[model samples]
Target: MPFINTSSPHQQNQSSVPDLMRKVLLALIPGALACLYYFGFGVLVNIVIASATALASETIMLNLRHYPVRRYLTDYSALVTAILLALALPATVPWWLTVIATSFAIVIAKQLYGGLGYNPFNPAMIGYVVALIAFPQQMTQWPVPQPGGALGLLDVLLLQLTGTLSDPAILDAVTSATPMDQIKTGIGLNRTIGEISTGALFGTVAGRGWELVNLLFLLGGLWLLWKKVINWQIPVAVLSALFFWSWMFNLYDGDLYSSPFFHLFSGGTMLCAFFIATDPVTASTTHWGRLIYGMGIGILTFIIRNWGGYPDGIAFAVILMNMAVPTIDYYTQPRVFGHQDED
Candidate 1:
């Protein structure tokens, strides 16, 4: 008698790689739109350039590796990586920087490690870290929030392409250090939180335009949770850990430590907590492992942001936690059914 071949997950939903990727892409829209509104057309241009480069690089790598290029391309994983990396980048970065980062993410970070499921790190974070380390100046050149006048599409294109503008004063007027940068510098100069918070760059909760961006991203992340695309353990753990640390330190010295609200609402905290750190392939798999992994990321991000060289530490924090997922899962795995401990 012939027997049926069945896998452990005999009951399966309709979820496929493409479906998951599509949902994630949809979830990113609100945050992306907010970035565009605050940062200008450069945000859109970065996405376009990064997406095109990701597709082209993915295709080339697939063809060279003798894989079925068309089938894999349909998954939209590369596009997600490209868009995530682009969003993490400064909107006004040179166009070639976007191209380089996206290509490296697809070719080295994703494909070089045997593609999607086999990779151990988040490709987008890897790409962003690479670009940041290689070109610190360009990576930190964030545009001022709600500039007096937004750069036109042509102006953005010209500036990104040639690293120059017809009017030098416009470039100077539009660019400034991000809120995270300002806070770090201010604290280093012995300025109190009250003093720094008075700057025009600081908004109600965080930065002028960044607070709303983070809130929108938080909404998108909530949507992803509602759609069942991501688990709750990672995000909840990350935020809880971050809040606990920031709140504790703020109590110690309000002048030296920023409030939890600022930490939560500034920079890419929401983005990392939800989307980047929750990457299924690179993140911890076991239930308890995810919590530990997320807590590790949250703690590391706080440490790096306060004392390390970078203004925003999400990229570094994610990458560091990604390296420990294997160990976390090994120790935190649930006991198998009918298994007993040897006492």
Candidate 2:
């Protein structure tokens, strides 16, 4: 008798790697559109460049690793990593920077670490952090939103390609401090939260155009939840923990600490809480472990943003928490069905 030896998950779902990746891409649509509307066409351009670079890097790396190229390339994991990294970047960064980041993400962060499931850190975030650390000036150059009379799409693209402008004054005119940068600068000047909140960078809760972007990210996150693409534990834990810390600090010194609303709506808080923290492979697998992992990310994010060097700490926070997943999973493992507790 020839018996079939099968793995544990005998129950079949219709989903494949490509299918899941497609769903995640769909979930990112609303946030991407919002970014385009606020920032300009540069957002889309960055995505294209990153996607192209990521695919090329993945193909090259797969060949070098002696893995079947078609098998992994069709899965779209590299594309998804590219999209996330592009979205995290400033809209008008140099094209070379985008290429380098995406290449590093796929080749070094993902492929070299035994491909997708085995990577210790989020590949997209690793790419973002590397770009940030290596080229701080280029990384920090964010375009002012459309409402602020930012340059037209063509001009932005030209700048990205050539690294220069017809009139250098145009570059100065169109690019300004991001909301987080503004707040950080204000705090450094010994400005109170009240004073900083009244600046042009702020609208209601966070930045002038950023709250809308965050809102769209929230909607996309909720869609992911409804589609069952992501589990609710990590998102809930991250948001709640961040809220708790922000509230605590605000209550302690209202003048110094920003409100929970600001913390929630500003920068990449919603995106990280929903999409980044919930990476199935890199995040904790056990139920209780996920909550602990997310809470760690949230608390670390809050600490780094408020007291540490970075204005927005999502990348650093996520990477740091990724290191703790093994310990969290070990402690939170479910008991075996027939096994009795050891005395």
Candidate 3:
């Protein structure tokens, strides 16, 4: 009998990279639809623009690097990055900014470090951070949520393309501070959380229209969990840590600090917990490392939201944690089975 050479861990599952990517894309649909319902057509426009830009950039980079373009394109990783970046962006952002962010995400954050699994940081987040830093005015201007979906498709296109509508009042009517920004600003002005919560933007739990969007995202996250696309450690740890910190602060002074529920359901909290922090390539591999990594993100996010310049800090927290993954994994790696330690 002849022995065959092969890789270790001969056992395999039915899931391929494309399969996993497909499931993630599927999981995002409910949240994406909710965004469209609440924020109007600009969200859809951003998705289309980002997706196109990402695909084109990926293809060009793969060709320049002499890699097999078709093989990589079929994996749908670029699409996922594109969609995530698009969703993070303000729905009212100009079309050119969307293109630039998506392109930079695919080309620089992703391919420059050697593409896909090889990249250390989350590509979507890198793009978002870059955009947020580069264009603070555009990035922070989140559209006021219109539950009736009042903004017509053409009006959104006109605004995105020209940076204005025929009537400037329309643009002014739709644009406003996000719930997170509102709370931050209100707090800065010495207004109590109670007074801020009475604003029209505040829903029963979190931001108006935003809480439901987050719930839909939570629904999608649960689906991802059920499908086993992601491990439970990171999400549970992130949410738990965030909740604990927020609860503690709120307990000390309800007038000064927002409640845990507000933090949990507001502005990318659920999305970051389930989708962003759980990026397998960037996150820690060890079981304990995952928990520690998640806790770091949660705590940092809270700190940044409260004390840092940015209203929401998920992006910064994630990137900072990504830089620590190597050290985390090394320290938290499980001991080898049956291996004895020297005294």
Q: What is the C-alpha RMSD of each candidate to the true structure, in Å?
A: 2.3, 2.7, 2.1
Query: For all candidates, what are the clash counts?
Result: 0, 0, 0
Worst 10 residues of 1 by lDDT: 145-154
CA displacement after TM-score superposition, residue 64 of candidate 3 (Å)? 0.7
CA deviation > 4 Å runs, candidate 3: 1-11
| Candidate 1 colliding pairs | none
CA displacement after TM-score superposition, residue 285 of candidate 3 (Å): 0.9
In terms of lDDT, the poorest run of 10 residues in model 2 is: 145-154
Model 2 lDDT, full chain set = 0.88
**For model 2, how does the per-residue alpha-carbon lDDT over 1-343 read when each residue is reduced to its tens digit?**
9999999889877778888889889888998898888888888889999999999999999999999999899998999999999999998899999999999888888888999899999999999999999998888878887652377767877888888877888887777777778777888999998998887668888887889888989999999899888889998999999999999999999888889988889889988988888988899988899899989998998999888877789999999989999889989999999999897
Question: 62-142 in candidate 3: lDDT tens per residue?
Answer: 999999999999999999999998989999999999998999989999899999889999999999999999999999988
- Per-candidate TM equals 0.96, 0.95, 0.96
C-alpha lDDT (0 to 100) for residue 10 of candidate 3: 91
In the range 245-318, model 1's lDDT, one tens digit per residue, is 99999999999899999999999999999999989999999999999999999999999989899999999999
In angstroms, give how far residue 276 of model 1 lies from its true place. Answer: 0.5
Question: How far in Å is the alpha carbon of 76 misplaced in model 2?
Answer: 0.9
Over 4 Å off, model 2:
1-11, 147-149
